[model samples]
Target: MLPTRYVRHSPPKETTTSSVNEPKISVQVLVLGDIGRSPRMQYHAMSIAKHGGRVDFIGYQESTLNPGLVENSLITIVPLQPPPSLLRSNTLPFIFAGPLKVLWQIWSLYYTLGYQTKPARWLLVQNPPSIPTLFIALIICFFRNTHLIIDWHNYGWTILAGTKGPTHPFVMLSKHYEAILGSFAPTASFTVTNAMAKQLRSRPYNVRSPILTLHDRPAAIFQPISNSEARRAFLARIPETSGFAAAIMAGETKLLVSSTSWTPDEDFSLLLTALCHYAESTDKLPPILAIITGKGPQKQMYLDRIASLTSTSKLQNITVATAWLTAQDYATLLACADLGVCLHKSSSGVDLPMKVVDMFGAGLPVVGYAAYESWEELVKEGINGRGFTKSEELAAVFEELFADREGKQLARLRKGAVEEGSRRWDEEWDSVAGRLFGLCD
Candidate 1:
């Protein structure tokens, strides 16, 4: 099991002579995607700002800045021009021009950083467009005398390999290129899980830098909600779910919530198939209000599939509703749910899903599809949640949890889920911020 205690580090004690000479710390965060979609980056920026460091954020202008971030005086938002049509549309030109576009953005970043009056203390960058951006950022930091911090979610090369096969020339080239660049000295390196940290340590590159594990934690925004409040908020957010809302109000339905990006990594069909099996095997099942949230490339395809299933009367007792939700609405929906379903299978088999963490924060028990070996640390079977590897097994789990008319099993799991959520990362990001800023003495 993963340790429950948060990682803590004591900063070096300072003498009176050195105390007067401490320079003001500043950080510049560079990302190639939408800032709003990048929650980890947001957390890093907020952590730095909260610890008295000024932050300059550079990213594309596709999404609005978070409302809280907009009002913060310690942070400045510098929007980059949106990528060209070919890159935005996911077309053939993207494969060739994507690196060039990232290079161009880094060039733009150089000018933005050059215009600053004070030299930044740290340059924090997210990887995946890893090699080219890292190569350029390292050279820039070398000349500017700034420390570099690379946060690894997964390799961009591995994502490409998933589509083009592991032996593809591009994949082979990326692996070699990343190794050469990643070996250079950096202030610190971070990954999302202990398993991923192990993978980074075992790489062929001779990186002497500390590789830290920083799992995703929910912000204070998500909290448990009363059943009545959750049902009302869910209905307000998704009016099309009136039938389900009615059932909820009548005390005749159980709410099942699942959040997805609708991407290839998550297998939504598995959940659908399990639902079908559960519906067919049980006769007097309670009405279920299943809400699936988020928008992505495969959304339309899944919507069509759901429509087809409903039209054919495959799932009779279950009412499935899919909608895109705002952050507040999403949290409220989760807070009200009796059970949360997670279908994420990591693309690199390393990164854990932030969605599940959000669910835990709301004290909702989960039925998750097991994709990684490290999942047992968080989703303890029959404790807070259950994990299944097959459709039949998942269906059985659903039956075991909800099929009890007395709600005894679900009440037990719910209590455990609340306890787990309460203990989910007891330490705040302020400690991480203190370590990054050399604040501890």
Candidate 2:
């Protein structure tokens, strides 16, 4: 349940002279989306609290939040009401729906920032809902004398362009809106990638911000389940694997996991096609239990398609299950799985997938889509994971990686993934964001 009222925390006092010189820190970590789905911002709140700063975490509480965030004394979860029903209706075209949603969001955000919350030294906000958020945040910061920091996950305009064509008037206007407001608070901006920083520095966007690249890293909960007993216990709890329990436990079948939002960015058809090809191949590869998790608009459509395929016996050698697991169960599944498949086709070519990071943290190798240039930063082809651009290519990669009876290639990739996973959230966050926010000693 969401907290019904706001309560602020004061930072602990120290008598040291250095403490006297340091700035008093309190930040409102704002996300204009679901709080549970916004892991990056969640990490930010945790890191801030760890560094002795107080955080008011604000977002819609549509899903379960991390207990760590909820339990922290330094962090407060402030829930925002979800948008109006009319804004969510598919019958309403975006041309009309977009403006109405923005207007409501502006009022809600203003009320929360202006009156409902305590005044803070900094306001760290997520971008890509940059439309009303950037505008409203700027206004609130100006009036309340709070410093604004925009964390650039991706461009709102580019994401908008993905649905409506790049030439759409709204897309163009959104780009201008982002460019104008996003350029403010020049020294206080952070981006997820160097590519984003470079883009923002050049051309029409020409942001003056001292953009720091703070890459996403897996949280502490995601770790390798090397103990066979632990793996067995996890598998036993998931009823979806009951049909092929022996095969999976005895290493006669492979567990392949993937997470998706079932959004337009990911083409599930490609994965289905590759799985079909894998089943038909006369290869030595084991049968697969492909489990995809997450809820989205296209989830039902894909579920129907998977059902249709199963009814016709087209996927005889493969079993597909879709689940909406809790965060802990999701981490355990990643740790127990043999491999992960990431179908993310980044809407903004500069943004990297957090799922890939989570998979690596579980010591699981990945087979990721290679459509975007930024994937190279995380995938590290032939090392930590392999990349494929087509269904046939994916099938071929799977055959090569999984066909060996000795499991040589899989072992090699898992070693690389484990090494990659060792570079975790705390170390990365403390160096970059910790210093930028003046939370470091």
Candidate 3:
């Protein structure tokens, strides 16, 4: 049987010449990135499907999707073709590969939307890979008479500036392209943060769009563990974590967990340096087993560093483990851990980290990076979590949180996280996005 959330209420059968139970609206939810990795778009599709709207869900099928989404009858998965393999070659210059990749995506996306799929009433797309996607989606929507809605996750230009300097001609050009096309749907667009919406409305971009802020919320699977035994049972099931189960269950070791994409935005070095501080300190702190999860381009590079750090006699109190967990297992692991640590320094300060949202949902206190101004919006320092810009600051926070063996401070933060997690995705979506999509009153 499907989970209660997955179970759909089928519309009544047609009684006359016209189908009475047919969905009144059909939406095309687009993401240029991997569908499995894009949880926000998936949630949008699920919400649409739940409210009797047909959703043509489109993106690259890079990983396993949520079972609930896969089982949804009202939603259709429209897989986008992955870009050329040459794009990944380190030897091939990006100047040559970048244009080729964009051209390929343009042709592929145009073909998928124009020829393969049926026309949707609304076309909702994720931005940041905005160059060709936004242009191509705009053309398709214009010709098809569909309403175009750009879901601004972050600025493509800002993310590009991370690699190429902000002054670079290519980055500047990309910014203009994004800003112009993104401003098309003035009143119908959405953003993840108010700061982003404010920027679009005020700056050189000057978007007329009333970009609504639709904050990310945890899915139903992200819930607090009821007891120690339940947490231990969950830990024992995963092969990578099974060895630490007994120690965790016995309360002899503090379990710290973090999830990362091993991307450029996340400063893993800060986390490693902080742990090094914890190891070298003379203070008698409890042994910590830090589990860093996620697979990405930079995983092996960090894994080698972890290996070198452990070889030295200077770091004895800390054990660092890495794993790529299934979605359900990841939630369970977060619930079982003592604390959550985030290193996601957002490319645009406005956007919040969904990983932090997931941690709070599992009732775990977080210690997150504080370089970005927007960190305060999600992680209220000294409340649900603490934020630090430097390794020393993070190390000090760890000392303070873990100083008491009884964990009074950790308990207080955990209580705050539980309160924050009380609100789930369904209610949030119904209240905000449901109205925008005309799915609910």
TM-score of every candidate = 0.87, 0.94, 0.94
Give lDDT: candidate 1, residue 43.
Answer: 74
Residue 365 error for model 2, in Å?
0.6
Over all chains combined, what TM-score does candidate 3 have? Answer: 0.94
Clashing pairs in 2: 186-209
- Give the poorly placed runs of model 3, Cα more than 4 Å off: 1-21, 185-187
Q: How close is candidate 2 to the true structure, as a TM-score?
A: 0.94
- lDDT tens digits, residue span 203-303, model 1: 75556688777777776677876567656757655674655666665547888899888887788899999988988984567767788988789989988
Estimate the Cα RMSD of every predicted model relative to the unseen true structure.
6.8, 4.2, 5.9
Indicate which candidate wins on lDDT. 2
* Candidate 3 structure lDDT: 0.83
CA lDDT scores, all candidates in order: 0.73, 0.85, 0.83
lDDT of 3 by residue, 1-441 (tens): 223332224422222221225875788999988999998899899888887888899889989998878898878899999876777567678788888888889888987887778777788999878979988887776666677888888889888999898999989999888878777643377878777778878766777856787888888989999787788788898876688889877667889999999989898999999999988888888888999998888999999998999897546878899988889889998999999999988887888889999999999899999787677878887789999999999999988888777888988999999888889989888888888877777
Q: What shift in Å separates residue 217 of candidate 3 from its native position after superposition? A: 0.7
Compare candidates 1 and 2 on TM-score and give the better one. 2
Say what the RMSD of model 1 is. Answer: 6.8
